[model samples]
Target chain A: MTHALAAKGPTASRPKPAEFIAFAVLAALLAVAPFALYPFFLATALCFALFASAFNLLVGYAGLLSFGHALFFGGAAYIAAHVAKVWGWPPELTLLAATAFVGLLGLVAGALSIRRQGIYFSMITLALAQMGYFVALQVPFTHGEDGIQGVPRGKLFGLIPLGDDRVMYYFVLVVFLCGLLAIYRIVHSPFGSVLKAIRENEPRAISLGYSVDSYKLAAFGLSAALAGLAGGTKALVTQSATLTDMHWSMSGEVILMVLLGGMGTMTGPVIGAIFVVAIPEVLNRIGGPDFAQWMTVIQGAIFVICVLAFRRGLIGEIAARLRRTL
Target chain B: MIPLLGISTQALFGQLLLGLINGAFYAMLSLGLAVIFGMLNIVNFAHGALYMVGAFAAWFLLTYFHIGYWPALILAPLGVALFGMVIERTMLKRLAGLDHIYGLLLTFGLALIIQGVFQNQFGASGQPYPLPEQLKGGTNLGFMYLPTYRAWAVVFSLCVCLFTWFMIEKTRLGSVLRAATENPELTRAFGINVPRLITLTYGFGVGLAALAGVLAAPIYQVRPLMGADFIIVVFAVVVIGGMGSILGAIGAGFMLGIVEGLTKVFYPQAANIVVFVIMVAVLLVKPTGLFGKKL
Candidate 1:
């Protein structure tokens, strides 16, 4: 048990040169991924990858398992879509506006949810997000069950038009890369160490004079904002923002990605996201529509298997083999 | 036909009765959750799914085998308890001594699989459950008319909750259960079969949930997704009441249900979120919940 917790915890080692090279290689691959794969699919995967990474920041580092991240991800999508379609905001501005709104929402939610510790924290987040879903269902702007749709892929910065699919894909990639870099910065910062300290032993951190709740709230807010970025990017990519984004199932999907890739490792969530997004699409292509119905069951099975046997996850296992923090 | 705050007394009382029925469900489900959490140290996320399964089980007994409600009321919970014990013995046993979060994740996975399979088989729509012959009529009081089944459900669930509380707080088996919960290692040292006791406690809690589901089948439609949304509200109720005391859970459940019903009558717009709003308010003032002891 101790080993399992230790394995999932963050390493305090400095970033090695090989890790930097691997990161550069990954970025280059992503840069060229659009040429080999469908840009739309790649773009969608990137959005989810970002979402998983943002989620990883909380669950992996801070050791706070929030079950309602869908509120931020899906809520931001709604806000971005509404502003782009109704308020005639440009793509970049709309995304920014959405991220900012979700960040504040995160602060409020984090404040209330952090009042309880452990499992209660998870339950509270879930209940709060469900409440948000009901509000979205009743609110006029969200259009209830229909959701906000047909959001324009307006010009980027009012300069480069995103009307073309490739242009929009490139825009998504840029946003995703920037989000990734920001997360990397955050994870490696001194604040990250404090978070890890709290994760390792909260009472010890408190004894050491760190305001643990404040740090947790900050991490939660930042994670929520990054997830918002992913959601906003998704809205622009898909040209729609619907209730599916904010549903509890969506929250479960993100958790699956984080777990599947590897929790607490920077590389795990991205890998997990790619596989999660690709698996469904692959099943749709290979299994026909009838077999597609098994996706939820399959996802559930993965969750069960991961929890029971593969707690280290794909990247975590790989890192264990290489004896280096990925 | 007298109006109270511009609403007829009949409508107000009718909603209040509905609220009480809903409260009975919340009380039962939350009580089950609290019991499971105490024994297992893991919140049972599949609880809602199991409740749904229980409802469907009753429906199956009635539809496929022509078993009536009275028999199903006893049989369904027993079947669910057996199923729960198997899961506890097999899957949950492996997760002992780990962080509480993994149990939640595993059960969550189980919930998804259960809900998904049922959805695939039944689709998303609700199936109607008929009231038994004994519970087919209504009784008119001075203020409002109350359906017999609804009143029975409220009274029966209230009795169950109280009986559970009494058993846990007063009986010898309950004392053993409490001792195991407080100190499993020490209890095991005393030659008590702690693990088996834990298993039975889990079964008891799950059986309670199934019993609630059986009661709910006739009151609400026996739907695949019925437990999904209902469970979240119960969680809020749990948060408000705290999982420390069983009676606290029951009281909170009934109080919040009435509060929700009152919202429907007074301000319809906030009825859906009133429980959640109350949760946030409770959290702000009392972080440990109303009856919760600091862990």
Candidate 2:
């Protein structure tokens, strides 16, 4: 709550009552979504939505495009899965530990990557993440090829068992809401303004006495921590952490979600995440991996079209049209 | 531990030769990358895919039209270069004046489409392209048994790399290209056709990748994923070489390939990752790359 109040967003205005009401409506909708939809799918999409939302905070709000977010998301998933399965840690402890570890990882990765700007920066992050992917494959604790399977969901706290699917979904939902709201507050906060200033013009920001690199690093660490949060929650929900999670392709998928949903908008990435995840799933239900291969072509086409034609994205364009933040 | 010191001179030299062959491809691909970047200011992310396309083009020509390796070598690159031209004029040209990242993203998408379509049509398992009859044999050297094709590949690619260097660095036409690359608007004012030069440069760079692909087809099994595997290493090579210097890109490619080969000999597990490790280290010391000018 403090972070949210602090971030008030890129704008430094008073807390508008409408913003609170809109967030409440969004929460109510997501809370009731599982009853109308598949609880398992909702749980899965929530993980990705959180991932994309966190990614948006960096790319959309902070003006840094990280092409290697899978380093955080998949890395944390593996760590959380390992701890839950082997160490028998409770859900909260595993999530906290995994997220914190990735935050540290992000700090190191971000520090090195911020040395380069623009395209070079993206490549640096990508190369480092690729290294992390190899680590996931070669490391013993990750179990190499098979990944850490049969991860125990464990209890939410000390008392409430989260073994039931419905209970687990609700737990995931609560975590998702916290992560989303935190991002919102971060974007609206004073720090977010500094980040925006850096994004808009770094030299000017530097001239104004802002430590641009430190701000960028802070934003990266925050983004990576939130991505870790999503990934850790996912491991608990799925009871597995496989290598595909860390693949460069998964990184691309998150970028796609952010681009499709609208980079800077509040709700764009979540909507985009749901769309990408859901479409593939619906196709999987009808056909197999062959059908999914076609999805790659479609995705590629979307990327080309989006860059050529629709840069604003669905939610972003809508928000612009309505003259109100979604 | 197995006696690392006891590894034979024959074994070491053999790996070195293999490394040189890999370096030949690396040199050719990175040279293409550097040239394209020089002209376009956009890294051609689909370069590896084009290389794969070149190999496939060769395969298709041989199977359907009875076009053998020698003829396919010349023809396949030409065909792929034409395709690259179309991509530039229609797609990549639109990305001009935008952030370099947009160009990167656009080409990345094209690569996915191309690789995906090929993978869909032909399974991921490799397809063998046999050595042409003349190049089928090998000669036993005191140091190593040099396959006729392997020696030819190393010498041939080195010549091509050098020739490309001469064309870009030495020739009168190259001076024009250099001028255009330096300042397009100024070059245009000097009565040069900058737009046409940009298009041709992209095609030529892509053709170089295809040429390497044709050279690689018989050596590495022609697979849909052949380029995907090497492209990352090439990116590492690019990062180390720095994008600004053509000579640097080629030099780094062969140099890193040897380094990778030596790593395989010393610490086999580290071979796959050694290039990336070096990249990080280089970045720490010289983020601008070894031969790179100030950005």
Candidate 3:
């Protein structure tokens, strides 16, 4: 693990021009993607990218694997949709309310979850999240099966109305970018260094006088909050919150995204999220309805192959090969 | 209305009995998980899926082979254990040197594959498996009418759990197993085949889950999603109970089950979340879990 930590050092210290160029090109491509592809599909990818990046914050950087992140992501979506649809709040206020509400929920969840380490932590988070899932299922606010649908995407901050699909796409893009930058900043901060230290060697970090538990709790909260951001944004974009958002399968999907892209790399989760979401959609288009059901099988196969064969993931593998050469 | 603490005594007893039955399954599943975790240092995420397979096995036996519950109980576990052994030999064995997370991921993938295939074949609807003739009837227990099979399930699971506890705690083989868990390399150096022990331990753990599955099939509908749904709650029970002690897992499972059942009586809407709430509370007070040792 320490060796893996060292592998990240060179990339952390420098930001090359190529990285900026790549981001610019990706952003340009995304900006134009809505015109070519379905806006809904692009928005879905954006939401997942944010969600996966949020997940990456914990597993990739903090060495914590939470199997229950769907609770935060999907739970917040339900809440935001309910608020926007039922209460008739403007989109901006609904997003804020959803993020704050889910963040608080995450704080509570994180506080409970950080008590155990490693696999126990994963199980605990998963259990708690499942509890949330049941609540979503049975609760009246979720409308049982129908969920809170037809959520009005009102004016953003009482200005710049977001009724059009292209406008909504750009709104989601901005939010996703903000989330990505937040994660990037957090990973580069001194707090993140301590988190990396804890991940590498917990006892050593504890011996160095860092409060490891608190750091872990903080990371968990941040990850949950960001996932909430994604979920809240998604609710607005989709104009609905379904049971699918909070399901355990969704949690697994986010994990797949992070694992496929590159766990610790900043850009990896975004790429992975896009690929995971797009591949299924693309396959659906090509293979038709029967292929839609097989998407899970494909995802499962990908998970097995990725874990068994390419542990480094896309960006991580590239970085490893570059390090060996340089 | 006759009230025992503002509720009918018979109804209370019935709910308690139901709670005990649920606890029985929780105890069995978590117990297997503890055994596997103790020896293998990996949480068997597929325990629930294996449990589901146990139920399906019973369903298959009855439908295809005309085997009754009596034979299926024994056969289902054996079949699952055989499958478990095969899994150990092939995929799980290869993951021995990797991070523990990979074991979880591998089992998760296996679980998805298994559940997905079963769902594709059987669809999401549950298949009904009738109880055996002997255990089909009910027993009048003065206070409430008790279904014989439910009572049998609770008592039988209790016996199995205790028997396993006794095997692990009292027997010489148990000592060797404990020694293996403590220091596998040292035990291996002493000519004990630790790897083989690991495989057997996994098999036994999975068998325990299968046994629970068989027990549950007659009660809950034999469904593909049944195991997946209950496993998360079991994970919570495992956390609340603490993974270190076998007795703790059993005690916590039953305790939480009763609490959940009681919650259903008083506040029906909260029945599903009561166990999870208890888990959160337990985690807050004792992060190491009630019986877990700090690593």
Candidate 4:
């Protein structure tokens, strides 16, 4: 509850017309962006954006810093990939199945973790996620270090085939938008308000007669679902779901995305996700034993600097200066 | 030699011994965690990295300086403690009045940095540490063969854990530490140099992790990832033990270790996740943990 996440929770009541127009413009830009941007790169960025937005719901809004979200993201990706590649499930079916599985995963994780407060809560989620990672590493279906690869994009609902890169890009784009809107609605909903209240002052919210744990659990569930949606879509986009997706480092990356974008702000995670995803790729372009190798080090430096100097992140800082929620 | 289930007595004892050794590591690491949390109110997410540093210190001492295991045990922890104190003085102390999560984040960041640096310097494939002459070979127990180094690990860590417990729970110095934990301002009122004490306490806790690391070097490959691997399990151990009670941390660590060992013998698939499953069950039944007094 320090820095931007602690600042006036959900100050804006709703997504304004301007904000709606802004989103429409952004969506439009994204749609026409294949000529300007790499489809795979854009798809990856969108997937992470969705992941970060989901993360922001708990962290930015509810003040729950879950360090093990990879359970949903990577775990769902694994499920989606396995179903799609082996079982030959349709894209829609795989997405739905993955989302459902991860949502259930989230509920159990949230239920266990929400019992503790503060640092203990973070640690529990992390430990559980790490256990999930162990399962991924050891379990037969996950293929251990090899991961599930060359997964077919397949047909969405057995109708629209998503074999082409453009079609896959739009599929990812739509999923990202839908997930983003769902998060926006959740954050602005009365339920979202309660989450904010719990986040702001748990004791006060409890005294006010709200079933705080349920609200927290519900938030956790929704967050995990959206994160699942992103991950499942990512498997389709990348045509693979590697162990990298579920690693604790990926969880750390998602946190960085949320922190970098502006934890509570709608656009923050999206902007942050894109920025973070691009940095390593940019460094890799300058590949050597020196510069590219420094990516992880730089990423670690970003975490330290963000916590120490700028917790509000880029969009957060902008919003702070403008005296408005970004 | 009693075999409870269909599992052989020999196998059971071996797993139990292995579990005991793991529990020893858990107890020592959790003790460090509990100490830091009680005094500094910081979760010290960098703990695993610090442990990694300790193991690497041993590796470096032997690889370059030709320092033997005995001296590395003393010197490695001392160096790590000093580094930890520097961390406390510069970075963590700045976040005194802020939310504790900042401390968690800052330390997590430090963990990433430390781990990243280690990974960069030493590739992910672990460097092996040779066994010291003093702790090599094995003794044949009535039930199972026990490696001397593993036996030493369990015994040495238990002694350290108990010594730490004694110092913090039984002595006048322990009372002062307790007073500071309760109310730093009140303790500072008595001219006790509370800030310095806080720094030293963090150092001591970090030293505990380093000590565990040094012990583990001969057992496991000295790798950058070793601490990260163990730290999460230790965190689960801490959660079950309850953060407030030192004895609880020590006891729970050992118990869970045995539980894990038994699980490995019976249900191997569930071994890695058993502690976490237990943590979830504990939270469901008692969120305050086994011995936790506070919410």
TM-score of chain A of each: 0.95, 0.94, 0.92, 0.94
Model 1's alpha-carbon lDDT is: 0.91
lDDT of 2: 0.86
Alpha-carbon runs more than 4 Å astray in model 2: A1-22, A285-289, B1-4
Candidate 4 lDDT tens digits, A1-326 = 31333264334366666457657777888889888988889988999999999999999999999999998999999999999999999999999999999999999899899989998999999998998998899979999999988999998878999988888889898898999888888887677788889988999998877778988999999999989999999998888998899988888899988887877888889989999999978887777556677767787788888887888999888878977766
Interface RMSD, prediction 2: 1.2
Better of 3 and 4 by lDDT: 4
For candidate 3, write residues B12-118 as lDDT tens digits.
88888899999999999999999998888888989989999999999999999999899888999999998998988887887877778888887887788788878
- The order of the candidates by lDDT, greatest first, is 1, 4, 3, 2
Candidate 2 chain A lowest-lDDT run of ten = A1-10
Ranked by DockQ, the better of candidates 1 and 3 is 1
The C-alpha local distance difference test score for the whole of candidate 3 amounts to 0.87
Share of native interface contacts recovered by each model: 0.74, 0.41, 0.59, 0.70
Model 4 stretches with alpha carbons more than 4 Å out? A1-12, A16-25, A157-159, B1-10
| Predicted complex 4: DockQ | 0.69
lDDT of 2 by residue, A60-121 (tens): 98888887899999999998999999999999999999999999999999998888787777
Candidate 1 chain B: 10-residue stretch with minimal lDDT: B286-295
Measured with C-alpha atoms, the lDDT of residue A52 in candidate 4 is 94
For each candidate, what is the lDDT? 0.91, 0.86, 0.87, 0.89
The DockQ values of the predictions, listed in order, are 0.80, 0.63, 0.66, 0.69
**Candidate closest to the true structure, highest TM-score:** 1
Number of the predicted model whose DockQ against the real structure is largest:
1
Query: Tens-digit lDDT track for model 1 on A155-189?
Result: 98889999787788889888988998898888886
lDDT (Cα, 0-100) at A114 in candidate 3:
83
